[model samples]
Structure formats: structure tokens, C-alpha cells
Target: VNQNEHTPTGTIREFVALSVRSINFVMNAFAWIIALALLALALYLLYRWGTANYDYFEQRRVPYVLPFSAYGRMLTGRLHPVDAAGEGYRVFPEERFSGFFVFRQPGYLIHDPELIKQITIKDFDHFVDHSFNISPELDPFLGRSLFFES
Candidate 1:
């Protein structure tokens, strides 16, 4: 046999190698497409969850203090909790209660002491469960606090 002549087995092996490379290329492309699609879906879902109840106050006709001002400021550590509460309180001084959000959870800030007493005393059981959340791993003390008792 001439050295330059291709044997049947050699030709088969070369063809198999080329086929594997093509399959790998296609699979890689498909994987990337799937990954990108998943990323986009996750982002969209997050956006939806973040703003799902943004119209809570508007629907209830309650005064809304733009959460981005006080809550957002507190989250970023740019404003103290007292300052944030003060700002929220000032926004609707006349309203008996106002709707706000602590990250996506709806909350009502009762401007009247009577309403606060009613919620804390008469309707205490109804309002026991709160949506505040904290990771135990991140903050053992606060995460395990009464805020998330329910």
C-alpha cells in the first residue's frame, strides 16, 4: 500500500472526529442560547416581583410616600431609620394612614396613635405575621428576631 493512500479505518476515524467537533459546536451554541434565555427570564421575573404591588396605595386611595425616598435611602445607609420614618411621616401629616413598601411588601404607616393602638391591640392577631425577612447566615441576631416570628 502507498503511504499517501487513505485506509478505510483511517477515513472512518477522521470522519468520526469531524462529526464530534460539529456536534460539540452545535451543543455549545445551544447551551449558550439556553443560558441567555434563562438569564433574561430571571431578570424579567425579578422586575415583576419588585414592582408587582407598586399601585397598592393608588388602588386603596391612601396617601403614598414614594418608597424610593425613605425606604430606599435607609437601605443604602444614606439615611437613618429615624430620619426615614420622619420623612415618611412628614409626607402625609394630614392622612390618618399611608401606604408604603419595605422592598416589595406592602405596609401601612398609621399617622394616628388610635389606629396604631387598634392594630396592635384589637387586631393584634390579624397583623401578627409580617413580611420582613432577613437571612440568618447574614445576621444571626436580627435575622432570628421577632420581626419574622411568623
Candidate 2:
């Protein structure tokens, strides 16, 4: 039953199997390459999104504090709200306000209490909503809370 037979059909079958495996390997390698490219593109887009508001103040012709990546100036602002506000305030102390980035969001920091009072009180109608509204679907409690509601 164990005859040493060098059949041409057996050789062709082995060659076909090897060819299929080679093709599969090449296809897998190409798929991996495409996946890596997409991952890199996603990461780059995320980085841009995180830093997109970095130049808002510059374009608006308002003085602004230098920002850090991803978290913007918010990282420092969160830790030291008064000091951070003062830093932006001093940048253009003579002016009424200066810009600061709360993460990717841009907002003006008023240096004078009178200006703040005018904006918050006298002109309250125009700017009724103080807190930024988040998605209720994403965070049910905080997003729909009275504190966030206008």
C-alpha cells in the first residue's frame, strides 16, 4: 500500500496548495497594511480635532494665552482657574478681555469685573446660557440637569 509513486498530479496538487497559501499570505499582508494606514489617519484626525481651536483667538485678533496640546489651556485652567484667567487677563490687561481655550472650545476671559457684570447682568438676554450643554444621550444625569439647562 506504501508504494513510492512520484505522480505528476501529486506534484501539481502540492504546487496549487502552496500557491493558494502564498496568495492568502499576500492578501493578509495587504489587509494589515490598509488597517494600519486607516489607524494612522484616525489618530491624525483625532489630534487635529483636539487642537483645532488652538488658533481661534489669533484669527479673531484677540490676545490669548499659549495653549498646550490636546487639552489646550484647559489643563492649566482647570488646575488654577484664577491664575490661568489672570495670565490671559495680563496678556492684554488694558483691553477688556482675552481668549482662552477650555479644551477644544474657545471662550473669552474678561479682565474687568464691570465688563463681566455687563455681560452677565445688563446684557444677560443676549447670553442667557452660561454653561455648555452636553448630550443627554451620552450623559443622562449631567447633560439634562438644571445646572446645564438654559
Candidate 3:
């Protein structure tokens, strides 16, 4: 028989099937690579969460008197007035002496209770104004209270 005469009728169908199989193989490989990358990212985040240290306040506990200035409280175990103002009600919602850090400064974490109490309740005269200055003309809705104003 001649080669042309002996050729199978299913030759075109076999070629189409082979092409589809190759395309599916490439797609499955690509999908597996993407899934592996996502898994790696998730593992890295879990490792960071497990190993990171967050003991900024629990290490030290002492009673100290702070100076009478907006920024001086940071020096005497009390958080900076500016940092405290930014936190609003988040810090010390029901109590005094919340932990805070000075920006770009080392060994600037504060955790004294007495000084914080004075600044918050007893001697409000010295620390009456906020360290942050916001013009009321820009934001008319700003509260007049020193603690809540922007």
C-alpha cells in the first residue's frame, strides 16, 4: 500500500489532541509556580509575626516626676505630649501612663504613672496646650479641647 493510501483518518484529530495536551501541561505548571510563590509569602509573614519583639513597655516599671513642658514629659518616663495627642483615646482610655515612643530616637519609651497622672488630671495648667498646632480656620470642626483637637 502507498504511504498516502495507508494514512489514518484520525491523524488530524490526534494532532489537535496533542496540541491541547501540551497547552494544558504548560498551564498546570504555571499555576503550580504561582501557588508556591503565594505559599512562600504567607510563610515569611508568619515567621515575622512569631519572631518579632513587642516588649516596649513591660520591661521597666518605676515612679518618676516629669518636668512641666509639652516635650519634657518624655524625659521623665512620660510619653511626649505630641505623641500622646496623636493617640487620642487609644492610649490610657480609663487610666494614666500609656507607653509611647519618640520618633527617630533611641531609648525614648516612657512608662511612668505619677507624671502621667499629673499631666492628665492634677496639673493641667502647665500642659494645657497641645504640642500639635492646627489652625481652626482650616478645619472648623476641630474641637476646642486641648486633648481632642487636631
Candidate 4:
């Protein structure tokens, strides 16, 4: 009988066991990495969704102020100015931009596109400067412009 043929079955069993263990370890490692990647992706999506609407306000460091009254509480901050204006048109039929407060500062939330168009184009002279002490003669053309008027 050949010595190789007569080799112990115990050694063969040990080799098979070692191979299976290594395979299991590799598979588990891959599974854990995949799970971590999925978790990171989910967290990113959640962050994007949460901050989507408030991104501009966050960038400007503005505080959000909620309105009072039962109806205001129910609809406040949930509706954008455009949508709110649509509903207001049906109820109040107004054709002007509305004012609300952000912290202590007053913010004009525009609703009417035509009014906005006029303010930005035709009636720009009235709304150009927000500051009281600014002199148009000093800067002339640039000082009279709305964007840099203040």
C-alpha cells in the first residue's frame, strides 16, 4: 500500500475546515463593508431631504419665524410664497407681495410676478435704496442700482 494513500483522514478534514473558514471570513467582510456603504448613502439622502427647502435660509443664517393663529399654524412654513399666493388669490384676491418677519427684520415675500417685474424693472427707482444715509451722487450709476444701493 502507498504511504500517500494511507495518509490520515484527520489531516484532510482539517484542510477542508480551514478552507471553509477562510471563505466565510471573506464573505463576512464583504457583507460588513456593503452594509456600511448603504448606511452612509441613507444618511446622505436623509440630510438632503431635511435641508432641501431651508438651504437658502441656512446659507443666509436667517431664523425661521412661524405665524400665529390656528390656520396659520397648520399652513405656516409648509407652503411656499407662490403656492400661498395662489390660495390667497381665491380667498382675498390680492395682487401684492406680503410682508413677514424673520427674527426682528422684516422680509418681503413676493407673490405677484407682475409687481415683482415692475419693481425689478419699471418702478425700480422707488425700491432701489434701502439705506437712509446713502448718497447717489458719490457712486452715481452703481449707487443708484438696487443690488448695490444699500
Candidate 5:
């Protein structure tokens, strides 16, 4: 009896080894497919997040300007913040207030003094608490600002 001889036990062992290799190959392929699917899902979710509030002012029938072009200019230093603000005001000169976006966050450009007074004084309490959270430990200046006192 030689070790190289093809005995029944040796044949069975070889078959088992080949089956394991095939199973491993299939499992690796399945894992890669699942990983690619998850990556695609994450990208789609990011896109949804970026566009979530794009139609916010439009749906409410508010006078608004799309900020993407201006935002891009500002990011590249081609447009100054003051110039961007002026542009927003010029776009809706007759409106008392106009809407705009900073990415997906909505904001207002108030062109009327009375409305500004109402929001700053008469309705001060309502606007006191901002919708964003800041950690004092990370950003003490902003976290301790009057607007974010609470």
C-alpha cells in the first residue's frame, strides 16, 4: 500500500476538498455582490439627503431663489457673501421676504423692516432657539452665543 495509490478513503477526501473550494468561491462571490449592493444603497441615500429640502419653498408658494449657483461661486471665492446677499435681494426686490437655501437648509432674506422687527423683537422667543445643536466643548463661542443660550 502506497500513499500515492487512489484508495476509496483518499478519493473521498479529494472530493470533499474540491467541494470546499467550490463553496468558498461561491461564498466569496456572494459576499462581493452584497458589498457592492450596500455601497450603491449608501450612495442613493446620500443623494436623497442632499435633495430632501430642494422643493421646500416651491411647495409653499413662497418667493424664492435657487442658491446652488451662488453657493458654488461663493465656495470658489468668485462671489463674496455681501454680493451674494445683494443678489438674493435683487432677485425678489418687490417681495417683503424671499426664501433661499444653504445646501438643504432653508433661510429667509427679509426685505421689510417691520417683518424684521416682528421676528427680532415681538416674536423673539419663538426664534430664540435655533434648530441646530452645538457642543460647548467643541465650539464654545457658537454654543454660548445668545441665539443658542438654551
Candidate 6:
């Protein structure tokens, strides 16, 4: 009863259906491609951010060893604390202090014993708050103590 084999306008109907399916497939692929591109961009930005502030010592003309990762030669640079201290001390013997990082935080290894004693004793009041504890979340007893307050 129909003009076409399947229906009255089966040729046009089949063509439209095929076009719609093709368009849908293309759209999905395009979306996936855009998503992947965005993910790559985000990762690139993170890497830049991590290493961005690494040259802090360089800007100030302070002596420093190249950072291992974003931590700036912290635990990763040496196996032991003493070894790490020795390395920093040996690098710039002429300099009074050497710059180091404890995960992006700048620190100094005072090579001079006199300076250390002076800072510890002469300026004890300036460094009264030695504790870096914040809240009693981990070690309930020790963290709760007033002596541990930063």
C-alpha cells in the first residue's frame, strides 16, 4: 500500500535516521576529545604551579641546591637528617647560611655555631613560640597541651 518499500517516504526517513546516528556519534567523539584536552591543560597548569616558586633563593642571590620535586631537597634529597645537614653545610662554606626547603617552605641552615647560640639564647623571646602544633586532632594528649601551641 505504501509508495516506498518500508513506508510512504522510507528513502528520506532512512536517510534522516542514518544522519542523526552519525551526528550523535560525531558529537560524542568531539566531547571526549575536548574533555581530554582540558584534563591535559589542568595537569600542565599544576606542574607549572608546583615548580613555579622554586627559584625563590635564586631571586635573592642566596645559595641553594636544586630542589628534588616541589619539596626543594627535603626528605627526598637525603636518607638521613644529619646527611642532609652536612650537604647543606658543605655546599657554601664561605656563606653564613644556606637556603633549603621543607616542601616549598624556605629554611636556613646556620653554618656558624656562634650565630646559632646567639639566636637561641640572645633572642629566645623572639622565638618563644617554637611549637607548630595546631588543634588536638592527631595526638590528643600532646596536641592539647599549651606548650605545643604555635
- TM-score of every prediction relative to native: 0.55, 0.61, 0.33, 0.35, 0.58, 0.61
Report the number of the highest-lDDT candidate. 5
Question: RMSD per prediction, one decimal?
Answer: 7.1, 6.5, 12.5, 11.4, 5.8, 5.5
Candidate 1 structure quality by residue, lDDT tens digits, 124-150? 787666767778888888888755643
lDDT of 4: 0.59
**C-alpha RMSD in Å of predicted model 1 compared with the true structure:** 7.1
TM-score of 4: 0.35
- Checking candidate 1 for backbone clashes, the offending pairs are none
| lDDT string, candidate 3, 1-150, tens digits | 565553565677678899999999999999999999999999999866643433434456522122123245556757756555445235445534444434322132234567667667877766545555666677555645566464
Q: What tens digits encode model 2's per-residue C-alpha lDDT throughout 83-144?
A: 66567765677888888776677878788889888877778678756667777888998878
lDDT of each: 0.81, 0.76, 0.54, 0.59, 0.85, 0.73
lDDT for each residue of candidate 6 in 1-150, tens digit (9 for 90 to 100): 645467647867889999999999999999999999999999999888877777899999888856573234344663565566456777788887788766556666788888888887787668665537766788788777644755
Off by over 4 Å in 2: 1-6, 69-95, 117-122, 132-150
- Which one wins by lDDT: 4 or 5? 5
Candidate 6 — which residues are off by over 4 angstroms?
1-10, 69-86, 128-131, 134-150
Lowest-scoring 10 consecutive residues by lDDT in candidate 6? 69-78
Error of 2 at 45 (Å): 3.0
User: How far in Å is the alpha carbon of 42 misplaced in model 5?
Assistant: 5.1
Report the candidate with higher TM-score, 4 versus 5.
5
Colliding pairs, model 6: none
User: In terms of TM-score, which candidate is stronger, 1 or 5?
Assistant: 5
Task: Please write out the lDDT profile of model 5 over residues 48-131, one tens digit for every residue.
Answer: 999899898899988887777778889999989777766668888888998888778888788999998898888888776576
The all-Cα superposition gives candidate 4 an RMSD in Å to the true structure of: 11.4
Q: Candidate 6: lDDT of 97?
A: 77
Work out how many backbone clashes candidate 5 has.
0
Candidate 1 — worst ten consecutive residues by lDDT sum? 81-90
Question: How well does candidate 4 score on lDDT at residue 131?
Answer: 37
